[model samples]
Target: MSHDVDVLALENQVCFALAVASRSVIALYRPVLDPLGLTHPQYLVMLALWQQEPRSVKDLGAALQLEPATLSPLLKRLEASGLVDRRRSAADERRLDVTLTDAGRNLRSTAESIPQTMIEQLGMPIPELQALQSALTAIIAAATRTSELTGEASDE
Candidate 1:
């Protein structure tokens, strides 16, 4: 018994589900990240940098799938928080690079526990969490593919 309702239409809205899940997950991370003095975006940058030091800004932006303008302010905030440093390339004056500081490296010890804590909080088994991550990665890849295809058509 439906009164002008389209449940299937609502159920098909992947964007809505994605937005809800992303917001909920980020919210769960806020308190856990607070002590480390990092926001979700900042934490993401640190993850990238933790794997490699002294990445060029352009390369970092590309690796993170972020535009420079969006990443710049986040990097500035990380710099202000003493977690990251931005400097010009010694040989290439035109290029700016980012390096994690000692404080940033130190913070990793604290952050190391975050994933376990979040898993406990999420109450999901490790296998289930891994499956969820794999699913999300595929969804992201498909979304990116669709965007790239549309962008190429538009450009042509």
Candidate 2:
């Protein structure tokens, strides 16, 4: 407790709280999503695809905040699971497009109940959970925007 300590001390770190909370939430999701044959990262990829049916690998990586190196392996796993298909873009032979297969599309039926399961698991009221989700969504959006802006600046 030195008075000369830096202002950026661990006790005042929102990042630390965010990281701990995120890990805890993901842990809660593990048992629920496990039966669906999805890891947290894989579920995130599915969420993106569900929102937008087909997207290029580059686009998916950008949306998921992953680099191709990290994303490729995950995509491979999903492809092997028969949940997604990665094919060469006919319009651009150099590019790859990832599309959810029929099984992947059908997974939404099973997954739709996950939100309720999570609420029951957390024992939180829907309103409270919605508030938390909103706050986290905003934080993620701001962080993504910041990263994108910084990336663009660095590339110039």
Candidate 3:
């Protein structure tokens, strides 16, 4: 082992960097999401739904890497806001189906500019942002695969 390598330093810890960046970037979305009546987590849920509606809670939880316990409350709030509806799936009574409401569908138009706004706010180029997102997605996939092999993914 080389004495030049300081493994204990915070700067050298990828987990620490990822954790800090995640918190900071989510924080940046707070102001941007507030006007749309969404928390960052809620916005993420909406994004998923906007892409594909009438999905099961389980499906959503999987896609968002969230748990039913954490997702149920958010769904309730979105429902209360008149943006979504939760119903029993037609084929399966046990599964809860979540679908966007008319209001929710309409909100997509308003949200179209949000991405550009955030990029402009960050003063970051679109290509750079795309690259960063790709890198993060890769990291998440690698972590998930490793976790699955180790049986830690059972929590998901």
Candidate 4:
């Protein structure tokens, strides 16, 4: 009974810890991203674009693990910011392609420092951070598999 009670404690809950940690870590990005005129989600979109331009919305959504409905508004905002241009694919009119504009491409040079800045701010060594990322990825995969097995819908 004591074990069960202790297990039920909020502090012992993985979900609670993850939720708090996620919020806290994202908060750290605000000051850094504000100067870049990006929200965390917007920054993620730009990161993907910086890696490869002319990505289809479907591909971007998959790469970002976001649904089309969620990705659409982000893309729209980026387009409005003149950081990206969305147009129909020439090979497939039904497909929309997102390409970084010149300004967006230029912004990458400035954004390059963000990773080092974040590392310094976090005060964690690269190896530790990489391990944490690996663990988190495994957790995500396990949670996804559980959701699938149980037929539960997950936005993530």
Candidate 5:
């Protein structure tokens, strides 16, 4: 047996674990967000809008680490759902602004419990989850910095 055997193990791959964990966690939100007419990505967009509205598409893309092409469709879907309005900015006709509609603002109340429900379903203590979040944030920052240095910001 080689000394690098452990390093080459599938279970030891961070990307593999992260990918599976992300998919699994997102799946947990499926049933919960279905009633709200949101997919996990759409739900994330709503969360950002709930925090601050009238943001430009560029701003949302940057905040969500999403590419413009990827975010455009999600915004269109949200607009069609009556949860948001996508309009040309009055100040800048070239820019698209995303704002919550009355329905979108009202949906906030219903979404308020989703996080807690997700936590309960995961059955993890809040402190542990918080720590996990912190670690993930650090990983993201490191990856972002690496990408900046390498000129390879997230391919997607």
Candidate 6:
């Protein structure tokens, strides 16, 4: 049988494409982020914090689409690196808040070029990249809705 006609062909699978693309694109950031002393996940956390300061752990989790268990270690590592500070929220002692240290704030300047760098690396024009991003976002929303409808827990 031709591979094109095989329903189970790995190359025909959307998940396979997405998984490979995710890994490949993240790999591109590895070298750039190394000098900043950040792993991909930690970089995501910093992005959220850089957008807004003193966000609660819950808020950060929501923004990053990560569960607390997964996010905790990242926060701990960022704190250890002196890039972030985590403290109990004064308004609500039970809640934890995260804020960037000056170092984390300064890192944003260096990171500002990353988007353009990745675009050049991918050799994709701005409009095409934007369209791809839009499509992927729609896919994510649809997948999340399907999971919710089926009462299935989303890995996202």
lDDT of each: 0.89, 0.90, 0.91, 0.93, 0.94, 0.93
lDDT per residue (tens digit) for residues 33-93 in model 4: 9998899999999999999988999999989989999999999999999999999999999
Model 3: CA > 4 A from native: 154-156
Error of 1 at 78 (Å): 0.7
| Clashing residue pairs for model 2 | none
- Candidate whose lDDT is highest: 5
What are the per-residue Cα lDDT tens digits for candidate 5 across 1-156? 578578878898999999999999999999999999899999999999999988999999999999998999999999999999999999999999999999999999999999999999999999999999999999999999989998996654
Ranking by TM-score: 5, 6, 3, 4, 1, 2
lDDT of 3 by residue, 1-156 (tens): 379989989998998998898898888899889999999889989999999999999999999999889999999999999999999988999999999999999989988888888888789888999999999889888888899899896345
- Comparing 1 and 4 on TM-score, the stronger one: 4
Residue-wise C-alpha lDDT for candidate 2, range 9-75, written one tens digit per residue = 8866878888798899999999989999999999999999999968999999888878888899999
Residues 22-48 of candidate 1 have per-residue lDDT tens digits of 899999999999988899999999999
Better of 5 and 6 by lDDT: 5
Model 1 worst lDDT run, 10 consecutive residues: 147-156
Lowest lDDT 10-residue stretch of candidate 6: 1-10
Clash total of candidate 4? 0
Backbone clash total for model 2 is 0
**What is the alpha-carbon lDDT of model 1 when measured against the actual structure?**
0.89
Query: Pairing residues by index, what is the TM-score of model 3?
Result: 0.93
lDDT of the structure predicted as candidate 6? 0.93
User: How high a TM-score does candidate 6 get?
Assistant: 0.94
Stretches of candidate 6 off by over 4 Å are 1-4
After superposition, the stretches of candidate 1 with alpha carbons farther than 4 Å from their true spots are 1-8, 152-156
